[model samples]
Target: MTTSMTKHALVVRGGWTGHQPVETTDSFLPFLKEHGYDVRVEDETTVYTETEYMADVAVVVQTNTMNTIAGDELSGLVAAVANGTGLAGWHGGIADSYRNSSEYLQLIGGQFATHPAKAPRDELPDDGTDCFVRHTIDIVPERADHPIVAGISDFELTTEQYWVLSDAYNDVLATTTIAARDFDPWHRPITCPAIWTRQWGDGRIFVSTPGHDLGVLNDKNVRTIIERGILWASR
Candidate 1:
């Protein structure tokens, strides 16, 4: 097909049920359509093998939970994104996924280590979890002006604060405080990158670690950041 007939985006979703891949992926469809992207949704792992899968697609939106992609299938995805196709995902969908694949980690540029999911269900406040619990997402001053975070503030979310051990190859956009937790054996405070972007050849890769549940994604503030990240990561 020609470019005019394309400009579509492929949303591959399916993995663990905890992340509610289907529900969350559905919530994002309209936004892509609003942005002029023809969206195609899939729940199968085989979609990766289709020769034209990435050829006519501007972006690949992955909402899978913990599924693995290996061999040439995985390589195809990396090559596509490296050659100008965009890859965008959030939370476990991207960072915490495919634990055993080095190539996958190299492609996405991050891996999820631990997420502090304590407190009562919805105990954290909206303004800021200032319990020292206070979540202050410090924006990288140089990257503060990025489109994905253009009008966003240093807001807070009471969701699962992901503690990631990411590749230094990323351009970190924002980070939250370093706090000591009993669960972490190291017992040292560590600053976590909440949002980051990386380049794969001629393409773009975007990831955010705040979406631990559907409610988190439904929040206006969280929703906006995710929406912008999707657009920013699209080819």
Candidate 2:
């Protein structure tokens, strides 16, 4: 295992508090440590500018939401990942981060456009309650054989289902469908990639969009998928 060596992982957390960056990143620290990683947690992006650290890093687990990244910082991150350091995150932490950097979006392979409902519901409603009601997510294992999602069956989640603007380069692992509910008023069903992996040079990138809060992250399947994703990306 990569972690059995002197592998280092950096957890950078900051940006929109609504995403609970610190708490969410903190929740994953133990898991990373248990895998034998020399982990470092930072609240700022300055660490990304440290070329020395970025050179040998194994994985970077980011939790920044809707923030601006400096040019040097962004460049440093891109260079590290392109040179083989892994990158992994969930929700706005990775997908919705650095909205202005097209390079960053291309590297991550997707961007969070909207969540549709503040909350989502199982059924469409006559009232506007469907606009923010709890809904279920059906995970389709398109890449069932992939290590990140192997043995994971379809599961449902009651959280913000993200509508992402993505590219065709991603190797989609799982997907969730959005019906033409009152909240979205879509003409037909919209299926979005819920989990995926991509390659950046010699590195791996993994993304999961179901983690809006701890409630969603704590789910057995979601946690397992993320844990496996981190390990897979590191390789």
Residue-level lDDT tens digits of model 2 in 100-170: 89999999998998767643456456463343335555555456888988888888776778888898999
* Candidate 1 weakest ten by summed lDDT: 125-134
**Candidates' RMSD to native:** 4.3, 3.7
The digit string of per-residue lDDT tens for model 1 on 159-195 reads 6677788778999998876577665456777887889
Off by over 4 Å in 1: 1-5, 117-134, 182-184
For model 1, state the Cα shift of residue 162 in Å. Answer: 0.6
Instruction: Output candidate 2 Cα RMSD.
Output: 3.7
Worst 10 residues of 2 by lDDT: 126-135
Model number with the top lDDT: 2
Q: For every model shown, what is its TM-score relative to the native structure?
A: 0.88, 0.90
- Against the hidden true structure, what lDDT does model 1 obtain? 0.79
Top TM-score prediction, candidate number: 2
Look at candidate 2 and give me any clashing residue pairs: 119-133, 120-133, 120-134, 120-135, 121-134
Off by over 4 Å in 2: 1-5, 118-142
